[model samples]
Target: MNSHKQLFILSCLSLVLVLLSGQFGLQVEAGHHIHHRSKKLFVFGDSYVDTGNTNKSKPGSWKEPYGITSPGKPTGRFSDGRVLTDFIAKYLRLRTPITHRLWDYTVPKHSLKYGMNFAYGGTGVFDTSSSGPNMTAQIDIFNQLVQENVYTLSDITNSIAYVSVAGNDYNYYLATNGSLPGFPSFIASVVNQTTINLIHLQSLGFKRIVVGALQPLGCLPQATAQTSFQSCNSTFNDLVTLHNNLLNRSVTKLNQEINDHNTFTILDIFDGFRTVLNNPSSHNIKERLKPCCFGVSSEYNCGSVDENNVKKYLVCENPESTFFWDELHPTQAGWNAVYNELEKRGLYKILY
Candidate 1:
């Protein structure tokens, strides 16, 4: 071969090698990005995400029919099966972290890799009808764990915090005979405190935080039961709308001030629930307002047994077809449907 031709062939081979290496590098980078999307999940807030955090003997979540759809028994989740935390963990491809209450000194150190769930069923940003830890107290416990070195800074930096305040405080307010005029102020207070909690989570080293907007409280079975589960109370949903609006604004302001558009995100449970309820067929939900399990009368609820061991409440034949499992919490299928909606609307951003 001529010297010039040999030189040209050698240069072409070198160029091909470079291109291959660049392609390989890109693939490896993409793989790493996918692998480390979220190393852990730190969950907070109320019953919506409470995966066995509430005490066993206290909340009805620890009783029968709560985990019937998933674990085949009650596992402290306030649903017929999995809740939001379970769905979020599945999305992140991580094991659902054990509840913080279960994180005793005896568990293996390596178990913390999945992170911890600090949510307590029926609790809120502040105290609620339940005696479980409030959102502030939940954060305090997390902070204490950080101080005790239960989780390193790197773990938190790679983790996502899922906070859910599902309007229990408002329920308590109304139940306690809180004035109608004071409802707005109470909503504002809840949102303000929740904003503080999210900021504090950021300060604690959580790189990404997801805060849930309140769902339609008026549409819950507790409210609709008055109308024979035929219709939702618009007045109560109006209060929920006001709360969600304030919460959305607060999250927007926080993201703006933090200067990281993805640092804080709102899960928009309000809209998610509304969409599911308004168009139940789209989500395969046959019964939107009526709970799958409920008391035969006003004094009992799902999983309630009579003194003579007779069942006081009745459970539906197919929980998957029902949106609500009880008066307050949704069935497992219900949460899965909502998660699908959120995932369709860019839940990946929070995970990645």
Candidate 2:
């Protein structure tokens, strides 16, 4: 009787094992589907979205104290850590795409499966002071890769393009002695060029393309530094609003022209920055204007060092508590907060 009971128990255990295996298989399949549907991310634009594609010898992003928050070292990101592109890729459940400049030597060609970043710091849609690849040049590189069959047609169709022009063009204009009274016309010209760039991307067969609206230039540390970081210059912000309005109309027109509402989206980065800055407590930021790092005086800037290799810039005690990282860029924490706000505003569903 004991031997018979033992045989019956063994048979029951085998049946339970089969049931557990079936359940595990379902979980695995679900995860696989999510990953496959996530698709790829292709990034473009200036310092706001650049992920280390600039010249290594450049003094800004690749210098010391630039990436002290996360990596604990500089990695060509203008912030203390990852920038907007990294966070956007994270939202899409994809790897932060590799820097386009690092492809042949440092990065393996097989890594192209995630997509590539063609953004260069300090670049604009038109030429800028940074003397880097403009938006058109960046697109040319992407086109070359496509022609070489580096990315399959399936990859192109499934991927989303992220374009972040920010305010570099306006900065270039102001610095180049462009007349202020004629600024509105200049703003129109900038928007027109940007629209052309968007159409060019669409012509390349991108099913979905998201571009960032110009953020509030008044709130940047560079502008607020005059007020000892106490107040923003509303004049700059008004100009920013003009740029954003024109950009919104342009994007809407593009979608209507293409007959696909989902084809082009204007990611309201301006709103994202304003919302996060206005509600610091909501995002755990102590203040929004003061930068996390800066040089000792006006003669120098973030990442500045003395002749003897001594650091000239001062970094905040805790970068996670700050918003802006330097005169122009946001810290990793700041970008995270902006990403959260954008997500709350439906960036996910709009993109995917």
How many Å off is the CA of 297 in candidate 2? 0.6
lDDT of 1 by residue, 17-120 (tens): 66765664322233223435337989998889988878887838888877888889989988989999999899777899988888963578777889999998
Per-residue lDDT, model 2, residue 319, is 89
Q: Tally clashing residue pairs in candidate 2.
A: 0
- Badly placed stretches (over 4 Å) of model 2 are 1-38
lDDT of 2 by residue, 1-352 (tens): 6988999998998777666556543112232222344378899899998988888888989988888887988888999999999998887777889988888565676688778999999999999988789998899899898898888677878889989888888888989898889899999988899888888888888898998889989999999999999888999899999999999898999888868889889888999999999998898999789999999999999998889988888989988989999999999999999999988888755677
In model 1, what lDDT does residue 13 have? 82
Which stretch of 10 consecutive residues in model 1 shows the poorest summed lDDT? 24-33
In Å, residue 235's CA in model 1 sits off its true spot by: 1.0
TM-score for every candidate vs. truth?
0.89, 0.89
In model 2, which residue pairs have backbone atoms overlapping below 3 Å?
A: none
Candidate 2 accuracy as TM-score: 0.89
Tell me the lDDT of model 1 at 46. 88
C-alpha-based local distance difference test score of model 2 = 0.87
